[model samples]
Target: MTAPTTSRAARAALVLALLVTGLSMRTAVTSVGAVLDDLQDDLHASGGAAGLITTMPVLCFAAFGAATPRLARALGPHRLLVVALAVTTVGLATRPFAGGVALFVVVSTAALAGSAVSNVLMPSLVKLHFPDRIGTMTALYTTALAVGVTAAAGLTVPIGEAGDGWRQGLAAWAVVSAVAVVPWLPTVAADRRARATTLAGPVAPTGPDAAGSAAPPARAVPMSALLRSRTAWALTVFFGTQSMQAYITFGWFARFLTDHGIESGTAGAMLAVLTALSIPVSLVVPRIPARHHRAVVGLFVVCLATAYVLMAAAPRPTAWIWVVLAGVGGGSFPLLLTLLGMRARTADTIATLSAFVQAIGYLIAGTGPLLFGALYGVTGSWALPIAVLFTALGVMTVASRRSTTPRFVDDELAASPR
Candidate 1:
């Protein structure tokens, strides 16, 4: 089915909303990594507490993202996103003022909570508004996401150094989140009008019955039924493992470089390079035909595994090389995001599948940084953390074998006897 007829202004507003929302999502998480040491020093946080800070994003995302479908159904996606962005702005602006480690985590969780909702809703919004243009829209927003990740990683240290400290750098993102809320506000009104139009219009179901009359409305697949599908499970594993690697990269890659005797600013720059590469890769990867996804996934796994080995073994001497490899591997993120749209037919199904994938995927991702920090605290090195990434890559490889196949959740549900 085509998107509901929208005024040009409404379309423009939606595009801006998607771009800025993508830009705002990662700043809360990545900004901290560049100034982590100073923040830890100020808070007098232990290594375990520091690990928890990095882990908080995924934890909050898992918790809040699971509820987004329900929230969107009741409030509408655009209106809910306006609330999410406002919460994000408030959380980002205030968290920097928290006095101790615990308060900081609490406030940061609030910020991540907002990001979590935005993250899950983006795919559903794209599917709803641009059903035939999924690849293009996914690339546009994911590229914007990469830009945000790169800017936050590369500039945070310098921003911190220029101001009072890490607080200034971290809080600066609140302004961007505030700006993102504007586009969404207009879209909320547009959404109401669109819904009214949909309700008032005649229902022309897509297919007919054997007697040649119009068919009934397609039923949305429930989340519980997804648990029984191998494809859903595989996609979940694929998304989880890739996110684990990504969170590790954002949370610790800068610190890893600094620990290896690289300057902090240079380390942040390397991390920036890693994220910046994803912009182009995100654009290109989503456009690649699904037939090539397995080969692409294999290539990404190789680059990621090799980067981990190099970083663990000889981080300083060839750090840039590792960053390049890892950045290329990070393309898997956009790949999986594209699949969220591809694997489902209707927007409702996309929302359900997207939530199912991200909610659980992030739970699995949350463990990466926590375990990375725990092992580094215990072993006094990065080797074990890198080893854990290697193990995740293996799991991702196995999972992608089924996930990358061309299939739809709607079809799977129709075939199920239950």
Candidate 2:
């Protein structure tokens, strides 16, 4: 789809709309952790069942992300975004009404399916509208994402305590989800008009420059072909591995800190700190030149690896130190988001790559926390899980280096079928 033209005022409005949307993306996933114990008590959910609240983000992200590009193809990006937000609002609002584990899981899965679409397509939106401000806009929305996680994690428990309890906490985020859908209505109208205005000229029957040829440049590439790119594989490895480690940390770190003698309130706050500290890094990292991402991201990965080592060895007295280290490392989140936009030259390529990276990448990520918890169940220690996290971080470092190599994903797609 062609980029929509806008005046400065309209562009700023669109940016604000995006900021609001970004705030809703992680709320459904991160808020669950704060009230997980309470839900287990109230709903009588097993540890495994309660855990689905956290795991659903990665799973729905993979599942929903796999379908987002086609929706975006059939409906333009702006309209698909509006559609996703409306569905998210429903999912978020309906989830709090569940009286049992099964219903809650179903609603949350629905909510997160919408979440998945937003997460995968957001980078393409930034590239489509703010191509000149890739770093700035990427950093902005990503910081909004970081803020969303911090708010949901840090506030959910307190909100639950103040009112009717866990249900209130679960329903609080739906407000934001509903509000974020408003600014895009105008843009959706613009997209429809643009689509209708495109001329469908007849094909020039048989020449070097034929009619079907003109439309080929604007058509969607076969995603099957994209999976064959070595660069695409490397990007998936990078995105998936880091996300795997993050899912584990987001899902379990609060409880891990509490087990080390930290108070439950303090423990939840530490997880918030880990996500909160990433905000500045997310805002700044994407603005820097791509030439520097290798060293910058590698350094962050090393810091993240160090946090795992510390958590494994001595998580008690130095709890604050290690968690901060983890947050600093988390700043690479924007770097990853930047690559989604920066690696593609056109909007279509950006959307396709975003879908592939989030779809395949998140499916790989969904196994992380599940297996980390499973390994702990089997080994009766955090050693193996921590070691596994460190290994994932190492693989991520290598993938980050390659995905940031200043290459276009489309170029790789054009090179061959395989």
Best by lDDT: 1
RMSD of each: 4.3, 5.4
Error of 2 at 236 (Å): 0.7
How does residue 122 of candidate 2 score in lDDT? Answer: 86
TM-score of each: 0.87, 0.91
lDDT of 2 by residue, 1-418 (tens): 4566799888888899889998999899878876877878888898778666656777788878888877787777888888888888898888877899999999888889888889878887877777777788888888888889888887887887888888898888999989999888888876687673221111111211122222234446556767777777888899999888887887778767876789988986787777788778878888888668888887897798788888988899789999999889877778888888777666666777888888899888888877888888898778887887888888898888778787666666666765
Best of the candidates, TM-score: 2
| Residues 14-97 of candidate 1: C-alpha lDDT, one tens digit per residue | 788888988998999889876888899999999889878876777788889888877776676777788999999999999999
Each prediction's whole-model lDDT (CA): 0.81, 0.79
Model 2 segments more than 4 A misplaced:
196-216, 258-263
